[model samples]
Target: MKRFLLHLLFWAVYLLQDSIMQFTWTMSALPGMPDGERIRLAIIATVIIAIPKAIFTYFVVYFVFPRALKYPALRWWLCGETLLVLTALILAHRCLNFYIVGPIIYHNIIRPTSILNLPYLLLTIMDLGFVSGYAFTFKLLRMQLSGKEREKNLLQEKLQTELKFLRNQTHPHFLFNTLNNIYALARKRSDKTAAMILKLSKLLRFMLYESGKGFICISEEIRIIDDYLELQKLRFNERLSIQFHRNIDQEGSLLAPLLLLPFVENAFKHGVSETRFNSFVHIDLQLQNEILQFIIANTTNEDRIQPEQIGLGNVRRQLELMYHDHSLKVTNAAQVFTVQLTLNLQSHAKI
Candidate 1:
């Protein structure tokens, strides 16, 4: 259907140009010639002029421009080719004008033989050169713009596909670890088992449904973090020391779902879990005006730090895709590992 519509539009424009050109010449000759004769000469000129115009356009654009002019090495060849083609086309146009259009116009349409004079022929050729040159330049510009647009669309599609795969990979790895934590509680039959189950349900609900969404409300993402922290608390209880702080300047901001989870998850998996005693995890969120800053730091076992730095790659890529110039830094010092991220939300805030 789209192709059909494009063809329809092309034919419509072509016919319109043909009619306008014929009408213009017919009106210009009306002062000296009868209406019927003037119209006849106009039609003849329009029809015959189309042939050389098409040939000039085709060779200059498709042949000369791409093969010769576009390459520096071929520029000299292009100069020679351009001169040869120009001379040939000008001579052809001159002959057609003198033998065909001029004779018909002189004998039938007008009394002046000046229409076939040298000056008249040169002026006519100059007019043809300007029109053909303008047409070629416009067509080249349109082609270049079209090519760039197609490249942009393809790049966007590839980025989306890569992001989706990363999201899919992240979900299963996170769920597997969380479910194991729940299983350990179920085996011992801890009193907090039911509460842990409720927390797990809410977190999983967000992950399976809301996290898959493109963007979620800022409140929803905060709640997910709150529930996830609570659920992880079940595993360490008295053994884990955790702190969470948040300051929100506005409540209506929106962000890419699941963007912040990997950093927090890394802190737990690497820093808190491996520490045998006196383990600590600190998470802070600060939103001022339009800037959001998140910091997560945890005590590391030092020995197992290298092994547990797993999910950061996927999170880093997601950040680049969603927030163009957002900042993220991770530091490992002695017994503590910290991750900090800052995002600008002024442009992305919802009502």
Candidate 2:
């Protein structure tokens, strides 16, 4: 709404000034163009000239100017060309108006010799001043808009970073919960529970201290998953099978922190606890054309209910907010769960 008003203001000022200048041109022509008919003709001529000027101004300011500034040579050329065009227009204003309107009025209003008079020059100078002033203000408005746009993007990124930090905190919370379970069992002097706690603690340290960064390497994420699977193996007593299959071309691909763990957590919430025996979790990763692809699937017992309440419902919303339309997919069946995620990784070849 504010943008609409500002646009209206710009058009109003341009149109009002053009109309007033043309009307004044007629009024100032003493023994020249007549009052009524002359004013109408003057307005028509002004409209004809000003319409084209307005179009040119918009194209130059919005399109050409943007490109011009990108190259120093183009920028200098355009500035010089603008000054030349404005100079020619001011000098030709009287000649154009007098030659075009003189015949229609005949000898009654225009004295032919005095048709190109002082009044017209003064009016042209005033009109040019208004145009130049509008151009300067228009450029200033664009500059201010660019600055404000930068600030808006910066603020948005800051908010997202803070939100991501809060979300990442969830991983440590989950780790502590799992560790507490293992610790409880260890207190009972269970040998398996003692080893599970050790593995869990190692994974937790990496997740808490190292992978807390905005992104982590693919190898590091795989290592964390391996450690997590080891901890689960101790807990489940070798009744569950987990496999990691990585066929990606690169080893150090990057991913957002804790993006994959939720899927594994969901797998455990239902796949391990509910399924009586011989459950499986399979994970795969591949990269093609600088796009990272991740796949995770787990078998669940038909009698075991789906873990609908485990994942953060808002995580999907957060991804949409952060990534907009970038690729991410997840599907869950009564006896199987699947998750697929793809990301456009930065590469020099593309640039």
- Candidate whose lDDT is highest: 1
Regions of candidate 1 where Cα sits further than 4 Å from its true position: 1-96, 99-130, 191-194, 302-308, 347-351
Worst 10 residues of 1 by lDDT: 106-115
lDDT of 1 by residue, 235-339 (tens): 788888889888887767777888788777778876777788988888898878768899998898766444445578898877777676589888877689988
RMSD, one per candidate, in order: 6.1, 14.2
In candidate 1, how many clashes are counted? Answer: 0
Model 2 spans > 4 angstroms off: 1-132, 143-151, 162-166, 301-326, 347-351
The C-alpha lDDT values of all candidates are 0.75, 0.66
lDDT of 2 at 47: 61
lDDT per residue for candidate 2 within 75-183, as digits (tens), equals 7778787767656666666555566545444333543355446787677667665665687677878899999999988987776775565566567556765776587
Kindly give the number of clashing pairs for every candidate: 0, 0
Candidate 2 global CA lDDT score? 0.66
